[model samples]
Target: MSDLSRTPLYDLHVELGAKMVPFAGYEMPVQYKLGVMKEHLHTRDKAGLFDVSHMGQVIVTGTDYAAAAAALETLIPVNIAGLGENRQRYGLFTTPEGGISDDLMLTNRGDHVFLVVNAACKEADIAHLKTLEPAVTVTPITDRALIALQGPASEEVLAALDPKAADMAFMDVATLTLDGAECWVSRSGYTGEDGYEISVPEAAAEALARKLLAHDAVEPIGLGARDSLRLEAGLCLYGHDIDTETTPAEAALSWAIQTVRRIGGAREGGFPGDETILAQLETGAGKTRVGLRPEGRAPMREGVPLFAAEEGGDPIGQITSGGFGPSVEGPVAMGYLPTELTAEGTTVFGELRGRRVPVTVTALPFVPARFKRKPAKVQQA
Candidate 1:
């Protein structure tokens, strides 16, 4: 812990009585005084503030926006060139074999592209982005802190500070001033709720966090609760649910790939492993990621081997992410199963403590998402 890097809000977390732990090479709070369960429920009902500065933030620029977008499209399997201004899209970096290198969020910020990538893979991701160097300039933003305010009450909480926040739709990015500091905000989050992810200057990060916490609906949430919330939402954790060996098609993330990058589309086959991925799109993969519900009270944690029958058979697949979903009030998990066994309601068995336990395949997102996809309607005067 002594050598681990700390975020700008590390001291604030200590003051709030957080249990600090090492995560992604950083000493971060895993839970506060309220604990994981309470913190998890609080975020679903109200708002929770998360210090996510450990993630990488980078800006890619070129002669113009199109040049930068085109350079980026060569690596990611997304239609970056068609991304609208102030809008964001989820994308992935694919390997030559069609496996996912990393998943990220990219925003088309007028003059340049803003990217937020996984914390643990930032170094490699940055190095990978440098390949687009001659065509685009890669600038790593190290002087900023990233924070997320997430929950059903997030909109009202942020709107109280700046009314303009209420007008932004889901996935919309904007530059807003809060507490007299310039902040880049995006109307999105990982908790399956309406929220905002803000990137603010290092000097102003603590002040902004404190201000947001002062609100009655906002609480200081830690990594433990963050994990549970995202698991319940059926979202993938970079290293767990997705990794270098997993292809986007097998991970059930084909939705993130726009048609333009697929076969028979105008701008197809430009990214790495385009042939492999495009073929997967036309012909499904052998195994696919699916939501799992372990029967009864016990949780089927990660790495648990999956079996097709209760006795005398080799493992079929393995659980990638699992936990007690606070919002769902039961144990939930996600893993890769054979495409033949991926149908909804199909039954499978998890080898829990050497005994096969009944588990059922189900649709993802144990809890429904509550994103504010559209702006609130206004009444005529």
Candidate 2:
């Protein structure tokens, strides 16, 4: 703890018997006394509270909406200009070579754009955004602490705190007062469950956490369960599933680029890696990210090289993310492979502990997502 930074709730975590570990230069809780497996199950069954203050939250503002959107669009491939008020969109920061610099969430708040970037890449992200300079102002919200409440019961627990939270749909964001704290609540989470991410003032974070934890449906969760939950949902884990060398096309995240940002669309593509990314979009990439399901219960850990069906041939790719899915009740993993071998049911093998373990190309989101999308409003007669 000498050099590692800690969140506002660090002392509360210690009081709860949290096992702290070094992650992204912060002393974060990886698991509680209940262990990772149980915490994973609890999140699926009830609700789990997570301290995500290590993530970066910033407000990007300018004199006008177009200027702010265009400034941000220059770095990412998303259609920032077309994002509706209070709507959230996912985008990737691409390098000039078309590789990913980082992944982020962008929310259009009418007057300004709100960004949430991965903790490990936050500093670099800020520096990169600062290149916009006088065109747009990038202000980091250091006084806030972010928390994620996820699971089926998350809505109920949050609704009890602020009934307005129940009206929000997936990716919807609003300013709400929860337990007397003015928080920025979003109906979005890394887990594939219905939930909310609340950003509150640092001083109010502990009291808010304690209030939620006291609820019968909520339990404290750590980074361990958070990783497993996101993995099961097929979500990328920044440095692992994506990195400076992996482009959006290779990472199976092309959908993050809206139609307006694609070739021949309104905005057309003026992003960092538009040329390379657009070319890959049209011609397809050499290796595509895919889900892998092992034939046995053996977990196919990351860095395990994957081989094609034929006995003797060059290795196509390697597993980027792998772990046992508590919901799937088996081993699940993801890796990249050639376009021809990306078809579902394509057989592939991985060398684990000096043995060739068989696996098959499978679709992602081993567990189904339960996001709450608002029903379409009926037109008045």
Candidate 3:
């Protein structure tokens, strides 16, 4: 099939009648025969299995903990030393000029740090990481398959298969066995829903996937619904909404930067583009990420021009990611605009087709997040 990369569950997906498409050099399913709308609905209602094996799974470890932490701090705003073992942190990769290279998840896997980076940017991330911290052993877990089981029923569905699913806390990771195979299960997801992402050995991925699919609440979803779900959840896609030109301040991700990594403190700054980030954190960034709600039925897409409200003013910001949000039950978009225009109810204009559609600057994650952060009974593996 074009010699592109394939996940361990590719065979199962093909048998399930999925429509395969190329994504980040991997032969991924865009949708099943039932289509994107159905899959999206299924994920919101029940549970959906997404093969995210293309994503980069890596381990960054070193005997020198403090040194390694500082080296990693130089590349991201997160205070690596602060995250406890088995705890995960969200962060961004900035350019030398204070722009985001990509956003990623970092889990302190006890002595070793686990990094799940974007698929397309994996090679570059690894190369850059090596240049930054060559002493740290960064090994890509190519023999693993990443799958996301998401939706309202995700926890119940997974717990039925593995009782351990109900015992892990949010943002925490635990090593467990699934269908007699060693797996790493985390209480995390991208759809703003209660779910888990399972990392399993490639050889057993297909077998586990089959078991999950057999569950009444579980359905095999594709990349198409995954995009819509994340978009509706107001999550940024690396190359699309976030890039070397975007910054944490503008992306509304400043919380990801720890206090130690801030402007002051003995830590100073080690990450790329600290000067710009510090300036923005102090003086405030002119632009910030905001949501938009179109007044009409027409949908405003990415790259559309943005105009300030009141008396038909000048251009301000543009749409980053926009589309009909199935969860929100209407058209919604995430974009950046002047801080003054970021206020809720701030009217804006978007050039839709040949007409300027009136839009209002709204809050993001238009749909409420259903993340299951409920405290679970602590259990040691």
Candidate 4:
């Protein structure tokens, strides 16, 4: 194991026979003895507990939290002023040219703001936030550990510990005491299911993780299954599905940009990419993200060439994230292409193994989302 960047659960993961790999400068578990396929299926059927400590946990504090939040929103696209205490919102940071800096989660702590950003872009995110709000105290909670309890059974697991935790609705965060350690629990997940992401102190995180695992419905899940689960949920992965070169519109992420915060009306805080993104909002983006299903069992990989699927079809797009979707029972991929080629029934080409593979463009998530909504609305792919 490398000593460079290790999670609080590093020792536990090693003891479980996980195949460790380097991801975003941190030594993490990609898979375990159960393998990716089993882990993926297990998460779907039961609950998967993941140690996501590598993700950056940042806290911004000031007497005037609202003003400071508005300032931070200047660097990202979101309705920060709309956030109530202990509420969380999934958002993104954008560049001046409208490209995405990274996807993140912003939470209101009543007096402080807590942010969870991608590990790969955490350093840059900190730098950018400092550039925007120099007077606001910004501190990276590097000594914290995060764990995601994902699946339909998460309610039961949490209810066993604290019934109050089960009452928190999606996108809401609440402070809870776990074995004398304070933890920030949020009713949010990446697996298109009802779950919670817990941020606990590094010292007590391992103990809490073990306690969560002791539950019958919860099992240790490696990063391999986490990737597949998020893919099925139609979530974006930094450095792959999204990058500094990719804009929010092209990434099918305009929803992250609050409409009220656009330039036309008297918007709140003016972020870096406000003008460019507002333009894209008014006028459609030329290129957009699309999902693809290959004709056969061959899985698509990132950086694979894309074509128009004609006799002399030229390269038109590239796959960002792709693989065998366990739930779909077929090969599926997501990438960006010309807006004209993003139609659901449109056919495209994914060049694989020196041959062009027939592909059909489909809507995102590729699989129906099982997220719990008040009206039980299921967003079909």
Best by lDDT: 1
Angstrom error of the Cα, residue 61, model 2: value is 0.7
Models 1 onward score TM values of 0.98, 0.98, 0.94, 0.95
Over all chains combined, what TM-score does candidate 4 have? 0.95
The residue-by-residue lDDT of candidate 3 on 1-381, one tens digit each, is 678988888888899999999899899999997789889989999999999999999888788566667678878878788887777788888899999987889887777788899999999998878876666877888999999999988878777867888887678788878888899888898988888889999999999999989998889999989988998888888877888888888888888787788877567667789999888887889899888998866667788889865346667889988887777677888888889778898888887876688888887778778876756689999
Could you tell me how far off, in angstroms, the CA of residue 296 lies in candidate 2 after the best superposition? 1.0
Superposed Cα deviation of residue 145, candidate 2 (Å): 0.3
Error of 4 at 295 (Å): 1.1
Model 2 lDDT per residue over 1-381, tens place: 689999999999999999999999999999999999999999999999999999999999999777899999999999898888998988899999999999999999989999999999999999999999899999999999999999999999999989999999999999999989999989999999999999999999999999999999899999999998998999999888899999999899989988888889888888898999998987899988998998888899889899885367767889999989998999999888888899999999998887778899999888999999989899999
Superposed Cα deviation of residue 235, candidate 2 (Å): 0.5
Q: How close to the true structure is residue 329 of candidate 3, measured as C-alpha lDDT?
A: 72
Q: Distance from true position, residue 70, model 2, in Å? A: 1.3
User: Candidate 4 on 81-193: residue-level lDDT in tens?
Assistant: 78888889998888888888889999998888899999999998998888756668888997789999988888888778778777788888988887678889998988887
Count of residue pairs whose backbone atoms collide, per candidate: 0, 0, 2, 1
Name the weakest run of 10 consecutive residues (lDDT summed) in model 3.
307-316
RMSD of 1: 2.5
Residue lDDT tens for model 1, 181-267? 899999998888889999999999999999999999999999999999999999999989998888899999999999888998889
